[model samples]
Target: MLIKTFENKRIGIDELTGQVISGVTFLNCDFSKVDLSETEFVDCIFYDSDRQLGCNFRSAKMKGASFKRCDLSVCAFNFVSALGLEISECKAQGADFSSASFMNVISHKSWFCSAYINKSNLAYTNFSKVNLERCELWDNRWTGANVTGASFSGSDLSGGEFNSFDWQSADFTGCDLTDSELGDLDIRTVNLEGVKVSRDQMSELASRLGINVLG
Candidate 1:
């Protein structure tokens, strides 16, 4: 399906059910308020040439798709599945990835500032050097994910799964960890200065640091 043929057109949810749309470059298309649930996009590229409006992926399922330099601000991606997804230098501010599942995906130099990523499964996903300031990431499962040089400053990481992880060169400055699960993590490795946490969390971290919190 050539997307240019559907230029200045609106593709709603009903028209995108389980359809295999490949090699279709969506340029200057508006996908706002569309429920593209369980849709398959292989080798497809989507971007807004205007750079003003963003294509909405509100509850859409994507596979083997790539996006370059697109704006995905404030879009909903609840319960979406994207395996081997590739995104580069895109603006995803305030986008909801709640309960979304991703695997073997590579996202480089993207801006996810203040994006909601709660209860999501991100196993073996590469998120190198992404800007994730003040993102809500509660109760998310992250296994075997590479976060080298990724910044999560001022983000909420409460009750999130953080097991068997490598956090080399990762920044967690001023993040909130209220009722969050942070076990098997060495406090001396990553940066956590001025990070907000409960009193119990402090005691646990202090013990790990070999400092007895007697109180």
Candidate 2:
């Protein structure tokens, strides 16, 4: 059975946490500054695919908000302070996070990011110009993700599937890229400074550049 549909409602901080929400549809709702820590959403729809509308999460504190097996396609997460947000085994296709801030600003130049987005399908998600540096973003399908001017620097991106992904669209310096399929990634054209890769991955990269790594 489908649960309640929340539309244009201002949900409280203690409204939804540590509870298992399933098959609920949220449309144009305001969840700003609501503490949804450790909340589990199963098969929930945060975006109306038929109408192309999405819920608002602007400046909402979603620390440790976990979403498992949920559909967050085309959702708007602009300016959401989502530290430790876990989105495992979910489909977040076309989700817009262009203006989201994951860092707690202690100063202008000193800050840190935290988010665990693993084992999910984030294809075509919009992360343009977002700062996701030093975060745990491993083992996800990132095909056609919009990462224009975004920074994934110093992030753990191991075992990620990046088919049809643009290597030069984002800053991936100092990223852990071991055990991943680096599709069409030309090392000579992109900056791989401090980026880690396995021996076999190195061989594959070398072959792409037409350099023979004979051992």
By TM-score, who's the top model here? 2
Candidate 2 global lDDT: 0.85
| Candidate 2 similarity to native, TM-score | 0.86
| Residue-wise C-alpha lDDT for candidate 2, range 133-179, written one tens digit per residue | 99999999999998999999999999999998999999999999999
How would you encode candidate 1's per-residue C-alpha lDDT over 1-215 as one tens digit per residue? Answer: 44433445567656766565655655545554454444554445454445544344544555444443444443445545554344434445444555455533347744334345554455544555555666666666556555676777887877766776775557888888778767566777767787887888889988877888877
> What's the CA error at residue 12 for candidate 2, in Å?
5.0
Q: What TM-score would every model get versus the actual structure?
A: 0.49, 0.86
Clashing pairs in 2: 33-60
Error of 2 at 164 (Å): 2.0
Quote the lDDT for 138 in model 1.
65
Per-prediction count of colliding residue pairs? 1, 1
Tell me the lDDT of model 2 at 208: 81
